[model samples]
Target chain A: MADINAIAKQFTDFYYQTFDTNRAGLQNLYRESSMLTWEGAPIQSAAAITEKLTSLPFEKVQHKVTTLDAQPSNPAVASILVIVTGLLVVDDSPSPLQFSQAFQLIPEGSSYYVLNDIFRLNYG
Target chain B: MADINAIAKQFTDFYYQTFDTNRAGLQNLYRESSMLTWEGAPIQSAAAITEKLTSLPFEKVQHKVTTLDAQPSNPAVASILVIVTGLLVVDDSPSPLQFSQAFQLIPEGSSYYVLNDIFRLNYG
Candidate 1:
């Protein structure tokens, strides 16, 4: 049986820690066997994902999680709503974006890894 | 027992009809006693809702329901994902907004009405 609260926390923490200048902490959160799909892009391996993240131009990216709704179904599956308040420090410009984040999570051992994520921004 | 497909259709049609200048068709889709919540606004009557819609600057509005996933549990509750591709003609400007639309549906007799909706837009 998977502890849903712990899984959800690890899932949320993955995004929050991505803000760090050192990408190793964020990369460590995902299992080497994990899959992460963003938008409609091709499924990437955890190592590939880490490489992509570290290549990004932004100096720092902070995600303040606003909501965490977890729905877990034993060993099969789990889903969570992770609404984040985004602040990106890029080129000395601070851009703030608010969005409701949804992550489809799957568990491996006691920890869970993200399968797919949808970040829907709210703007006029 | 309510047909899940039928309920989903009616809910989607309501938003599409609102795009038409004739407000009555859209109004007809909702039960007088039905509750519709958008954003985090207070509950308002169907009549009040109609007034609010008609008062908007948009001369026309259309909702393209891209996806609908329904979960029904007997007479107690149901939920549907209604993703709308929105196009609003406001002040002679055509504004396009793309987002995933979610409706929390509750059944009343043979028909299901929306309890609340969350629309999350995607922007860079």
Candidate 2:
């Protein structure tokens, strides 16, 4: 079995990369059953999540991860729980907002797709 | 079936209350298989988590939750994935540190115990 930490690292890299470069393309990372919570607002399903993310007020955003943690949730389904703390600069703004995000990734064939995702801005 | 959001709210209330009043008593919220990652450091088992939490530098701490989100992870095991963003004041400090925590709670009889817990401070 692949190490959960390694897989989480890879997923975070791919996730933020796609999120920064192309927000709409993030839909591929989710399934029909996927759920996304953005700043306490719930958005369900892949297409809706993609739409919500793409419709963000800022046009450009970059995330710099400060910490990433993961643990195996269920060996039966090979699901991994990953949490990330990061700084995000939106629209080339000098002020970066601190944020945290959690993702539950479950196996889909040889790879994984996000099942549960929750995000929050940590500071005002 | 109970709502995951309600359960998550209850858990957060109990957790922060126990944490602020009696840090040692928070041990009951975990299981032998529990994993805790505190600010990127990994601690396994309930005992270790309680110890780590209790041994923090501050004598008094309080958590004010800003947002809480939860989603049903596995119906078979009745596991819920919960994420919280909050501000923590340590030792009555004027500055409140922003933080985020994630929990994977699985049913144990009528209640739930944390199986995976991860926490991180949002900023330096």
Candidate 3:
């Protein structure tokens, strides 16, 4: 049995760290087959995912994570479902946007990589 | 084939309307076997779920939905996965909290009811 909560917290911390500082480093988080549903649009592959991230309208952003939850897939699959909610400020916006993200992570060696990720902003 | 997008939008609108006005009416949204993961804790059964909802610390809440996305379970299962993100203001709070919620909706007759629901605030 894995300490899923600990892994989830660590991964989330590392994920947002990279997201806030080095968006380029996020390339290692996904693989060729990784899938991303970003704001209702689907993007796949590491190259495409990186492209999408780099193309976001906001040049600088900060993420404040509030909730982190994880659940292991039944039947003992290596993947875990992680849900995150947070506030995002883009380009020094006065009001931070609320965001929710979910990811399916597969363990590889001592670390885990995202298999499927979906992110959406809370308001229209 | 269902007009999934329309149904999703309509369901989201109705959901928030009831949430802000008549919290008691939320009971009809779930069934006996409905499951809820509220901020990381699991609550099962309609009575339990309702109890949890009514016990929320915030006396008055207003939800401003920013995103609503849905996908049907493959193999023609009657369930659809709905993901939502938004801002939630409780009482007269100055800074509204960010919230993310996901629901598994099962179609029953002409309507759909939540079978599994998970909600979490964005900040600790």
Best by lDDT: 2
lDDT of 1 by residue, A1-124 (tens): 1355456676667556654556755566455544443322333557776776677666756665544434331222343322232333345555665445445455457655654344444444
TM-score of 3: 0.66
Segments in model 3 whose C-alpha atoms lie over 4 Å from true places: A20-35, A57-62, A72-79, A87-98, A106-116, A121-124, B1-4, B20-35, B39-41, B57-62, B71-79, B87-98, B106-116, B121-124
Note the B-chain TM-score for every model. 0.59, 0.95, 0.93
What's the distance in Å from true for residue B24, model 3?
4.5
Off by over 4 Å in 1: A1-10, A31-40, A73-92, A119-123, B1-124
Model 1 chain B weakest lDDT span, ten residues long: B68-77
Which scores higher on TM-score, 1 or 3? 3
**Model 3 pairs whose backbones collide:** A66-B122, A66-B123, A122-B66, A122-B85, A122-B86, A123-B66, A124-B66
Q: How displaced is residue A82 in candidate 2, in Å? A: 0.9
How many clashes (backbone atoms < 3 Å, residues ≥3 apart in a chain or on different chains) does model 1 have?
A: 1
Q: In candidate 2, which residue pairs get closer than 3 Å at backbone N, Cα or C atoms, i.e. clash?
A: none
For the predicted complex of model 3, DockQ is 0.26
Candidate 1, residues B1-118, lDDT tens digits: the string is 1365466667667665654657654554444443433332333456766665566555655555544433331122344333233333334456665444544455557665554344
Candidates' chain A TM-scores: 0.63, 0.96, 0.94
Q: Which residue pairs of candidate 1 clash?
A: B19-B61
Interface RMSD of 1: 7.4
In model 2, which regions exceed 4 Å deviation?
A: none
